[model samples]
Target: KIKRMKNLPMAALDSETVTVVKRKVKTKKKKVKTERKKRKSKENTSLKGKSEPKDKKIQVLQKNENNSENVESMKIGNGHDIEEKVNEGKRSKEFESGHDFEVELPNKKQKSSFRKGNDVEKSGEVSTGTVLKKKKKKKNKNAEQNSELENIAQKKIVGIKDKMNAKIIQATLNTKYKEEKLKTALKKSWSSNGYPLKIDTCDEDSGIKLMKRLPPLYYAPIFFNFYNLIDSPSKRISMFYFIYLFQFKQTTDLKNASTPSLSALRNFLYGPFRKYLMNITGIELDNTVDMGSSLYEQTDVLLCHDDELEGRRIAYILYLVPPWDEKDGGTLDVFHTDKNGQPADIAKSFFPVWNSFAFFEVSPVSFHQVSEVLAKKKRLSINGWYHGSPVNRPPKFVELPRPVKSPCHIEQEDLYSWINHVYLDPWTQKEIKTKFQKDSQIELEQFLAEDKYEALLEAIKLKDLKWHYEGPANKRHYEVTKANKAGELVRECLKFLRSEAVFLIFSQLTGLRLHKLAPPDSEDEEEKSSEKEPSPCVSQEIRRVSHGSYTLVHDDDPVGSQYALDAMLFLGVSEKWTQALGGFTSYIARDEDEELLTVLPRSNSLSMVYRDKETLKFTKHVNTSVKDLLEEEQQFYEVNCTYYE
Candidate 1:
């Protein structure tokens, strides 16, 4: 049964996590004027180098071998210590079937030490302990061991066993080849759309033959592939291979391992699998293949990216998930690329199918992401890239710096009025300020006055107003209207964003000089537009949005490198708020990949976080997990504000 997010301020909906992926009809290449047609772009490599004369496939693949990824990364996992404290009294811990390579789950019965506040018990940063050394030796003995394991094979396995190869696929479904699957002259069609590509069969012969050629193909194969291959599975390898750009974690790998599964699958990948993929996609690759398994249980997610790695020709994945749905997440979510080649939004998404293979040739525009898994089942899959000759080169494109708002002007009289009306007392304020200076963040439970919060909540729910979604989802999925677009009473609440009362509250809580983001000036008001650097003082913007109606996850703030303060004002949906439904936010330590804090966007609460230059934060994705509610209570809404410091 699906776990429900119960007692949430916005009671969760029971609706299936339905994703309406907007798929456009395939557009044939159109003729264009020579001047208008942009030249075919090559790999800019973005942040990594590309296009050297030599084929670095073997070297690169060898370096990337057997990487084990922490499925939840810092998202949350099989009940880490933090999870135990957070889920205390409400949820039970679940484990990965094969092995417990993860750190110990938190003990639930401990006293709840951290809450919505600045006074958290300081926890040490996570370190993997094993030191990587540069010394090299002993390849012969390792090879001998691997050779022995390969000969002692396990019985056959296939993930999605129904469609083994073309013949079996044809026999079972009577699927006549509409076109030859692995046609020699076939060329990849992924450049136009960064959407996912799927093939039910490799066009090989039978299940027995196909099964034999593949690895163990165990259900949820992550532990078997990553942990067992390691010289020591208990000690996690401290390296990070981001699933997509959204989710990243220190991964476990077989870089120093030589296991039987790896040996058995070696010849097949280098020979048949390699040859067949090339014939079908019509993309050439040398004998090098770089691959590994990624396992994700609930709350784990892989966000968006173009997969622009060095020497990566085609990025592909073969799933070994239990029976699942898009709701189960871990889906191949493809995005639309803007003409400039940056990811735009999600165009299509496909569920993880057993024994199925999906791939796309890595390109300048090949953007895709994996949705956060919500299902109770594990999503285990092995992903790899076919490496070949490098693509052409192009100069990197640098984004122009966006100007920050000038400080908003606040009248002294109105400031005093709000101070008297809603501010925290002076003595308590001093304590918070002291804590903020030391820790860099704070949370305010019941941040707003009861009366004002009630009025703001009612105004935001005005039925006549329409809510819009920013699509092709790499951008984000919250409603289109920023909080400032709400009706009068709700807009009145945003005034707090620029109010001296909140500024003082912020100053006391974050030790940062807080200033209001100036109301945007008209273009005519600028005196010769120039990029003026943002002030060190804080500036703010408010957004009113909702995602409780369905499932979603947003980008890891694109302008992440900058320093700022982010606030979430939970509009009191009244007594329904609960943590299980997770419309919460997390602050990630930039240097350690550690999660510094998680704050629930609970009603009547204000979660304020200081974003130092080295850290990034994201609101955890959420969807309706309960049903049958009053229409007004069906969605959870947050009045979001960002203050740049």
Candidate 2:
């Protein structure tokens, strides 16, 4: 989920909305004069004073156009002026239309089926519509039942009033009142057919198995949050919030976990709620609910991960929010499935509603993320995992495609062509190697051939071409062109990177014995089925790093990982790109707080570096200060390849 405006529309995070970490009440859009119809929800889970909050409008000012050369050149506008303007728009919209925000759900067919406690076995793949009809019973809303339920609740409350602890929470959950109320909410949730479970599979073409998916998620409702008997502290519960507020300035930071305070919320989740989950889903959850609640605010985001932790079976989130506009950010954006049946770009975004309870089975294709919150509001939720069940059929592991062997030596003809495209001469190459030997990193500007670079720049502007929104927003936010669909220039770039000339050049420049270069594509079935031969290198696709595009820090390289030489060739960049506006890479020594090197993604610059055991690197997120004069202005078109020595 997005911490603030950073996650919503990365392109929109200029100088407009302000983000403050706190709890959110729902957004009220309309009021009616119709006679009050008594509500049934109160009878079961009565919080008489805890009624749903109407919309509380916080006026946000749209950022003024400031493509001024410097990142700090943005001029701040008056808050009062912006607030008044927002009010004017709101009033007029209310007069003209019944709604304040536009509600747009994507048009997609949903197939979901779940039966009640009795019909579990037959319900696995049945139609939800047919089963829900049988589940909902017409119970009259009368004072007699309400009073009886309230009386039972008072007795249970008085009986367990002593020693406000975890046992009490577990006992209360077993009580008929809590069980009945939660059961009703769960049944309604399954019956409502609110979540979409489509056959979103992976694209078999790519080796990054993560991009493929087969997901059918459950978006649990609001009442799910209060299922626990413990009274969660008013101060909340989001550790994701403080990370951005405190550590936004640091470039190497990754995710922030929960701070221990809200024992009530944690106990409720791990205790009785766990039992209720078993009753509904028919899966035995693990003993402990790893109580790590995530809070994503402005720029805070959880990138793409499969959540394949040991002992974890299902991943769950209970949002502590009132309803609000979907555009407010804090959405659970499920990735679209690639040809591999793995998760790909973001296909759908589920915004945080105060009472939302959403969960999904942790599997290979279960790659999901939080989009940037474009608005100034807080997206708060409690997240945990239920472990100890048989891993929902793990997808077959797919290794990155085998290396495409190129010649070990560079021919003179290839050298000349490379020289024409890139401005590196023998002397400059010598200088680069010398600097690399000392620092294990070097940046060479004008690295791409002039004509080739110019042609590719034009090719990227083609509107007919489809660019995948590379996601799991916590890890990265950008787009990538499918090289197969893209025409000549993209093809040529791929070839050039994999060419014997460039490989030998890089090998010599870095003093590494690299032989083969790997492309980011899957191997043939024969190759996949056969015994794997030892390879000399590993690499990935040519990526288009655009606005809000980022790579967070993590201990990614395995002990025996084949990544010896890493290269990032920057292209398609505008002159307006500045350090203050991000789009830079940060290299840090794992043992210290110091950032070892900062590499800017300047146009036509290639930064090739050696990875030491104690070092890690990441591309800083691109900010919204750039003019975006052209569509490509937001992009860092580059070939990130690797070599095994």
Candidate 3:
């Protein structure tokens, strides 16, 4: 007889726990079926031929059938514990196939077998595959949750970065009044009908109509009465002056500043502002920042330049100055280029207005400069270039052929009449030659005859002389005497400096070969004479130096571009002249910022310097103080002569 199990109630479990228990029950049922097949096969073998044992075999078969029916009943029961089925199935399989496998219990009235089996399973009898399957499911759920969290974190990071960039842009610009106006200004095509329209924010009915007829040049300026919340990056800048050579004070290395406000402003301009410009101009701009804070004190100036470096797309300035006007002399001046691409006349001048922004496209014709600052208040501004893909540049401009040199063939008495007698002495000549050879330069004080120097000084101040102004203002700005337009004494002084006698004398003094013959001190004179004689050539100019006069190192000046022996005869300089009033010539190595030498002006002194191709020279701009020190003319003269062999 088979035992009947009592139905038992159980606490509800989660779906996953219940599923694990049910799968274990199904595996036990499969094992029970295999046990029954083995028992039946053995019963069939035992009953093969013995008739006397047939009745007993039949009874054993009936008992096996009853056990199978009891197992099926256990599987069908709702409250049967899965642990009981697993343990019962194992016990049934453990018995030998020929042994009787019968349950000893009363039907429907015995201790519950499932409860006993639950106690057994609780003593650590769970299968390894069931534990591993539960662990794997939990791990998969954790992995999915971690991926979702990472995606959320990544999105937050990107959003924060974008917000920070926007904040920086808004802080640097006074967008309340300027943003919409700027957007409106950029809407129009930069150039139209062969002319560029002006972008002026001060007035609505500005020069747009008039500009249609003007030459093609792009210019924009934004003026506002209000200031931004961010401090001006240029206000606290330290300055180093170039003196009168270039004459300005500017901050060096304007990147990665320690100051918080300066760093923030730099980020704004170099990042968001650059992207805004790229969008407006439709050009690919670079990420690098090039900028500096500048301070222009009184008399400081920046001469004309196009800002046309490789990859430079646009030039910009943000004026952080006080109220200003044209009289202040620190205006941003734009120039028109002539047919030869040289800066010509000033096309427009924009005075520094407090909190104004200005910019222009950089090109071969975009010549501009900062005029000399005349006000005592400092002119403060932040200026820089926005770099982009480099545009196709025309070949470098080659200046017109230099004026032909005149042959040296004047009388010897003419030289004697002007040159100091001390310079004529052989012993004195040897001393100058020795010094010149050592330094490649010399200054001869009282270089002319006493009487001749006195006459020339007085003649230079004559009002009858016709002065021709020289410019494009980029390279030089001064006066040159018109042909036959100076006094007779002044003309004679110029002629004396260009004479052949002076050339040979200069050769003996400086030990340079200026004629067919070698210097008097040369050892192999016969050998030098046999060689091809260098053609002796000379060119001279008489320049009038006054307030604002200057000569810059430009490609157009032969002295700046080639090797030459330069002799400068200074006249009419007052005894009270000081270096502070400028008008000194400075020599520096090519492509270098360091000043190598400075030649200060003194009346009747001659400055001779042999400059190689690697050297460049410029006369500094004379300030208004020249008027107080000199006579009413407020000017002096320089007889500049260059010798070529």
Top candidate by TM-score: 3
**Residue ranges of candidate 2 with Cα displaced over 4 Å:** 1-217, 224-261, 285-287, 335-341, 344-348, 360-365, 387-396, 402-405, 408-414, 417-427, 448-456, 459-504, 514-541, 547-560, 578-598, 612-632
Better of 1 and 2 by TM-score: 1
Per lDDT, the best of the predicted structures is 3
| lDDT of candidates 1 onward, in order | 0.47, 0.51, 0.63
Q: What TM-score, computed on C-alpha atoms, does each candidate reach? A: 0.55, 0.53, 0.68
lDDT of 3 by residue, 1-645 (tens): 233322233222211122112111124678767765765567545232211222121111222332432221232123212111111222211111111112333232322111111121212344321101111212242444334443443454345434543444333444432355545555343442234424423435332211221233333434322212245455456654453346777777578653434556677788877877666556678886687888888878888877778888877787878778789899888886677878887777778876667766777777888888887878988788888787787786766534646554667777788888999899999999999999999999999999998888778777777787887677788999854787888878777776777777888888877765544344575566567667777777889999889877765565566668989999888778888888889988877868888999888899999989898888888876676763754778898888886
Query: How do these models rank on TM-score, best leading?
Result: 3, 1, 2
* lDDT head-to-head 1 vs 2, winner: 2
Across 413-500, the per-residue lDDT of candidate 2 in tens digits comes to 6556554533346676667667887888888777766876777777866778787766434344567777789887677666667666
Question: Stretches of candidate 3 above 4 Å error?
Answer: 1-189, 192-202, 205-238, 243-245, 520-529, 630-633
TM-score of 3: 0.68
For 343-383, candidate 1 gives per-residue lDDT tens digits of: 67555566787655566667656667777777777777657
Indicate whether candidate 2 or candidate 3 has the larger lDDT: 3
Which stretches of candidate 1 lie above 4 Å from their native place?
1-182, 185-262, 279-284, 296-300, 321-330, 372-378, 389-404, 407-424, 482-484, 500-505, 508-510, 515-558, 573-580, 623-634
Worst window of 10 by summed lDDT in candidate 3: 92-101
